[model samples]
Target: MGWPPASAAAAAAILCLGLLASAWAASAAAAAHGPRALAAVQPQPTTHGGLGPRSRHHRHAYAAMMYMGTPRDYEFYVAVRVMMRSLAKLGADADRVLIASADVPSDWVRAMREEDGMRVVIVENLRNPYEGNLGGMNRRFKLTLNKLYAWSLVDYERVVMIDSDNIFLHNTDELFQCGQFCAVFINPCYFHTGLFVLQPSMEVFKSMLHDLEIGRDNSDGADQGFLVGCFPDLLDKPLFHPPENGTKLNGTYRLPLGYQMDASYYYLKLHWHVPCGPNSVITFPSAPWFKPWYWWSWPILPLGLSWHKQRWDDLGYAAEIPVVLIELLMYIAIIAITRLARPQMTKLCYNRRPEKQGALVQGLIKLAAILAMVAAYTIPFFIIPCTVHPIIGWSLYLFGVLAFSSAVINAFLLPPLAVLTAWLGMVGMLFVMAYPWYHDGIARILVVVAYAFCSAPFLWASLVRVIDSLQTMLERDPYFPRLSEPAQETEFSKLF
Candidate 1:
């Protein structure tokens, strides 16, 4: 009996080791077919656009954002203002341009136009087939179809696109001389979307749109993907060396890495010497815990203090304080409304007996199923000999157990919002895993796949409840409906 159990354990261990080995190999294999493949392409000159030092056409650098509303709205507004100021300080201020949706406030438009010297182009008529939150692997992305509109600005001979997060340290206007399409390598083989040069034309615009219509997929589900797809031959081009000693440009070239250094390099440089020094433009990529703007984020990144000062000096503390105060008030009001409405919504939507509607039981069942699936997937790994698997496998095994347990506990106790957050969090995790930077293979994919399928029912239920809760408030007047009476059941409620 002892021998049989030991043999079974040993068999399970072998199976898990094989799975892990395959996963590692799969991830490595995926890299070749992915962005790494794109990066590996050697730079080669294209026949489509002329490669010369000078063009008589006007060159413009553009920065754009979808100014929908709320707290982030002011942040980008300030960013554009500061970027313009930084450019002017460096004597590199070309004609500043902004691409915005129709919904942007008239006052903000006037500010950018009158105060900042920015030409605001409204993307009112532009329509894209894939313009929304694509909720699968691209859940974190908002359709960046708007960025493609820059190609429609025909007056400029070339447009160097800069993301709002980028901070220019010096005048790098020489970039205009690089090429028709130019960007620096970011991923192993792919270029970053943050900073790039494009020659604007109706032909390019139509071509991009056509590619979209034909269902061309971007690896990241954003503009970067489409651009990479459009210019598949980016890597082989000569690295863009800045024009030196009044020499004329030789050939099409990639922007040097110094043009778009990650702000994280700031930390590394402080502790140790690194190349790509005195970056031309430093970009602060997104992170949830901190940003270069927040006061708390300053200690680690004092260089951003100057950028903040520039914003204040350009916009004035008096002017800045009131705008921030108004934004804060707006945020508070939105939160207050949501808090006051939640109980009213719950009371109305669920027939005032949310607990009795099988929500808790269903959630519990789903949680249990997820936990069981995770356990089944993980238990075999523990049976493997102590040294067979990588430390990453052990770490992920622990993470799955903890994540499943938390979901189970929260499923019954917390509101649907918690469940929805959990589901979205898991989705976000999958995106992180899928990102080329993660450098993992089949094991991670298998773990995610197992968890996602097992948890799908719970995710669906949670989403339905959250949507129904919001819809209930939208349909009825809070005061007029009266607490004594509940609204009729929704079609969604019946299905859920």
Candidate 2:
């Protein structure tokens, strides 16, 4: 039997009360620790066992720009910080190297060299000789062409070049065992510039410069294209096999796909219910703003909120309760309003019975509703605390994209499990915010209130849908009644 609307509302209220009570308990537990306790709870950054005995001395290189004249200096600093942290966690015994133009700020160089414990290599004579096109538009490939300088680092026997936006999930120190010019086949039979192993030599570097001076047209107009042009036979190269038991190695090797899984796989695998086993690294090559360092970007991508938690730890920036409260309330309001309006919108968009109104009226209503939601949610971000508001707006924007895209695809209703997963994410975020160094006594109380006010109703509604869906599946009941059959007979027949 279906629940009455009044009963459902009451249940939601009870859930809210329960959440509030739990929040109070959590706050009390936190109070027991005293004022000085939060410092003890801040997670210590991972420290690497630098250069152990028998470890090969290979260097890892990252190419990035500071854009001196522009206002993107902070961008370079954060990227370098996250990359250095990831390297320190996984690149134990391996040398951390960065290649930047002379225009890069001295502060960035000092931070990487002294604070991050990386070797900063300054390339003063950097310039791009080749011009390339991006999406049929003419552009210079000079910035990308700088990656070629890694090959000129002949001081290192083997080098692993990675983009600054790439995050290491596991110790890829084992990639050094592979032969020269090893890379994964992720970008349409070509190697992704995110992570690749190469033997540094002056000869290869000089040859690449020669390719550039001669006006070699790399079809894609980037480093990846130039590299593909340089090695036309890379696709035909045999799979990489590491030398074992004193065996001799001869051919170029392809790195395992797990070493450089693209961010797209995170969502695709989840949609397919496929398990993404431990990856050696996860690369965010597209969209410079989508890097995981920013709290706003990572949550929209796949992977648990745990990834963001780890970043928060490294950053040591605890979001104020007001920030999280503002975020949670906005999300809850948006989700509740959207879900409530969906049925009417669906009927207006696709009515089984036609009305006198034309299609234009329906389209106009949808467009207005979308515009209203976007404005309502987006305007609040500007008012919230500057540091955390971007994350709040970003989260809402991504969900908005998902909702509208689903409508466009004619799959308006997400599966109950999918909705449940999203609800759980909201709940998990609140709890993460409750941890030490993240909240004060008053902030903790505010968190509890926010949880009760926002998460409770949303959770209750999602749970109702999930339970109803599961019960229907198990009972094998018809989801719709036949209009052709008599209503009295249909109701009476069920008694049999």
What is candidate 1's lDDT per residue for 285-359, written digit by digit as tens? Answer: 556224554432433344445566666567654432332333234334433443443443333332323234355
TM-score of model 2 vs. true structure: 0.53
Clashes of each: 11, 1
The list of candidate 1 runs beyond 4 A from truth reads: 1-58, 69-71, 125-140, 244-252, 271-278, 319-496
Estimate the lDDT of model 2: 0.53
Off by over 4 Å in 2: 1-73, 130-132, 135-142, 245-250, 271-278, 287-289, 304-306, 318-376, 379-496
lDDT of 1: 0.54
Reference-based TM-score of each model: 0.51, 0.53
- TM-score winner among the candidates? 2
For model 1, what is the alpha-carbon lDDT of residue 5? 37
